[model samples]
Target: MRILKKILIVLVIIIAIPLIVALFVQKDYAVEREIVINQPNEEVFDYVKYLKNQDNYSKWAMMDPDMKKTYKGTDGTVGFVSAWDSDNEEVGKGEQEIVKIDEGRRIDFELRFYEPFESTEPAYMTTEEVSNDQTRVAWGFSGHMDYPMNLMFLFMDFEEMIGDDLQTGLENLKSELEE
Candidate 1:
């Protein structure tokens, strides 16, 4: 009986530590990355404003070339939605819609994931003119982690997980634009 009590105590401590730590972990997370492309600001902005063009440089879309995709509304308009579904674990299923657009300056997206898990997040892309011939493009995603699920942040990496993909997507965008 004493040994069992001791084992129970140890197990409680192990689980308690992480639970306690999770309480203090930040609930919101954001991932962002930027790249400069030699193309002019308008040129870069025009390319990204059209959601369909994403297939050419989006790292996530590249994950599953055969993934099924569907579109609604106009491609670059504010209500346009691009949804994708894939049996591939990484791609799973998700839909992104243009929530706002700042002409040739910025575009904001609302992202909803439904496959492995379900959540809605905000993402955006901005274009800045560095010079007549150069443009800076920034891409970012942000969302809040819910309750006990946020606890996973203690062990899982937020930046490395999605940030790498964001960075890669930016790099691919740069290359595509410069080409």
Candidate 2:
């Protein structure tokens, strides 16, 4: 009986230590990736700012080729929303709404996921002229994860998980723009 009690206490300590440490760990996360596209900043920004144009470069949307999509408002303007439902676990279901647009510079989106996970985040794309015809485009997302949800990150490689997707999307964007 005494040995079992000691084992139980040790097990509790092991789990509690990480949970206690996680409480002090930062909960905010942001992932940013950039690529250079051989195109004018205005042209690149114009293409990206349009919600419907995601089909041309969004890696996630391509994950489920037949994913059902619905839209609201003007696609290239602020207040535009593009929601998708996919049967694929990886693709899941989500909606992205254009919340802000800085013509020739940036476009901000509010991303809300409902299936496979429930969360919301802010995503954006920015374009900067690198040369007379080359443009640098940056894509990223940021959000806060409260308490226990944040703790899961300690056991996961957050950047490694999403970095590939962002890089692929950026590459696709560059290809589409250059073509």
* Per-residue alpha-carbon lDDT of candidate 2 for residues 24-58, written as tens digits (9 for 90 to 100): 98798888999999988888888898888889898
How does each model score on lDDT?
Answer: 0.92, 0.90
Q: For candidate 1, give the lDDT of residue 153.
A: 84
Off by over 4 Å in 1: none
- Flag regions of model 2 displaced more than 4 Å: none
Q: How does candidate 1 score on lDDT? A: 0.92
Q: Supply candidate 2's per-residue lDDT for 86.
A: 97
What is the TM-score of candidate 2? Answer: 0.93
Where's the lowest-lDDT run of ten residues in candidate 2?
154-163
TM-score of 1: 0.94
Please give, for residues 1-179, the per-residue lDDT of candidate 1 as tens digits: 99999999999999898878778888999888888899899999999999999998999999999999999999989999999999999899999999999999999999999998899999999999999998989999998987667998878898788899988999989888888
Per TM-score, the best of the predicted structures is 1
Candidate 2: residue 125 lDDT (0-100)? 93
RMSD of each candidate? 1.4, 1.4
